[model samples]
Target: MSTIEKALAKQKTKAPATNDVVTEEKNTESNESVSVNPAPAPTEKFDIFIDNEKLTERGFLHTGGNTTNQQEEFRHIKRKLINNAFGPASKTLNNSNLIMVSSANPNEGKTFVSINLALSIALEQDKTVLLIDADVLRPSIHRELEFENSTGLLDYLCGDTDDVSQIIYSTNLNNLKIMPAGKAHHLTNELLASDRMATLSKELSSRYPDRLVIFDCPPLLGVTETPVLASLVGQAAVVVEESKTKLETIKRATSSLNEDLAIGFVLNKTIKTSKDVYGYYGYGYGRKR
Candidate 1:
């Protein structure tokens, strides 16, 4: 073959190699573009909403109460209930700092309200708060806070350690601490009513008098735990599901409680209508439906 023929053959082979390089570069660029532009976040799902990290943010909208007004309204109710008690919530909280939250039935949003109330209390700068998931049968506050479920009140009561301080866990919130319930046992009520539980509370109250201790106990109806649990704590809060809970049911629940125990009733999943708010705020309460 001539020199030009040989050169032409070489160019033809080199052309295919150059084209392959171009194709590979184009594919790489396309993938880079796809990687850079991700799909928009889905906010519609229930699990996404509940499990979202932003849901736990201090002032994030729609997680607990929707707006500032709603938070203030709930806070006012908390204050009023605290005020109506004999020594007042502030004084009682200052003195002993132990608060127990319970309900008439299981699926009544008791845990939700208890967790939120603890958050509300923790928002206060000066107050240091400890939320104990004393509901041994089914503990959720620990899961909600996304803390380790390894150690807590159960460990302390079972004499896992002499120091209760080992169980206390610090969270993102400045003043708030958590004591999550460990493995569930068969006889929770008896364990709770034992001397160890009482000793733990007494020691905690004495150790951190300025700190608020919120105990999420079992329901009032299903088990005898609430009454037994209430007897141990200084005060109790009953979470009544709004629209679902009847007056008779609430009355029955109140009857179950001893009159001496200062119990405050909280309406959970409460809907606000025109009657609840003036014409100014429109219909919806939290995060615009």
Candidate 2:
């Protein structure tokens, strides 16, 4: 087990047992006492808006709700990721919770996978998730989530916002939050590769060790910024469109990533053939060790 898991196990084992007799006495007294009702606490609201129809149409698991097939597939995928993040394998990772999702080229469904993976991880009882729109050149996460464009990672890195928390927006899904890609800038690549970005990355990983931070980055082979961001994250998942993306492209794209980072490939939009008894279009994972 990892140190974190061992500690949690130990804590659970050492927890105090409930006192049944004391609870019975308190309940007996409460039954004889007068009852007074209290007002309910106000629900926390977020400024962002989510279009359910759009989200459903895009195959995203509904926020704070449930789905069938897609949700199950992502749950299986996220399980392996979480194990790599916090299990015995995580010892070599600098910030195991910080993960980036990208593809070799555009329209490979990287953003779609990124958002789904984040949502699935958020469904876990013990962890929270922060989905960051890292594709500054053509940010699509806000558009995917149906939220208006706002300040985010770039704004904080460029000194436009001193506090990073200001850029993070909470969602109706209690455990999920988002960091939108801020307004477009000419020097977006330079800003992402800057020392400021490195500091912010460290701060994010350390501040909330239990939070899973998923970055929806640009395509690897064609984009300069994705590689830079990949180097900072401890783990990365490359989304490859099955039967469409070439083996050479996958190799070339993954070559840019840091060798120390744990790399995995997600075969997306796979179509079932006559050889397969079950016909389903979904994603599958393969680890690159």
Candidate closest to the true structure, highest lDDT: 2
Question: What TM-score would each prediction reach against the true structure?
Answer: 0.68, 0.78
Q: lDDT of model 1 at residue 215?
A: 88
What would the C-alpha RMSD of candidate 2 be, to one decimal place?
10.8
| Cα lDDT of model 1 by residue, 1-289, tens digit | 4322343354334322112111111112111111112122322211111232444353221322223555555455445433433244445342235677887888887777667666666555346667789888888875665545776677767777555445665453435567778767777778788987776677666655456678898888878777777776666778777678787777777676655555677766655654433111111111101
Among all windows of 10 consecutive residues in model 1, the one with the lowest summed lDDT is 279-288
User: Per-residue lDDT tens digits of candidate 2, residues 103-177?
Assistant: 999998899899888877765657888899999999999888777777787887788977555677766454677
lDDT of 2: 0.73
Q: Please give the distance, in angstroms, between residue 104's alpha carbon in candidate 2 and its true position after superposition.
A: 0.2
Candidate 1, residue 279: lDDT: 10
CA lDDT of every candidate: 0.57, 0.73
Per-candidate clash tally: 0, 0
The TM-score of candidate 1 is: 0.68
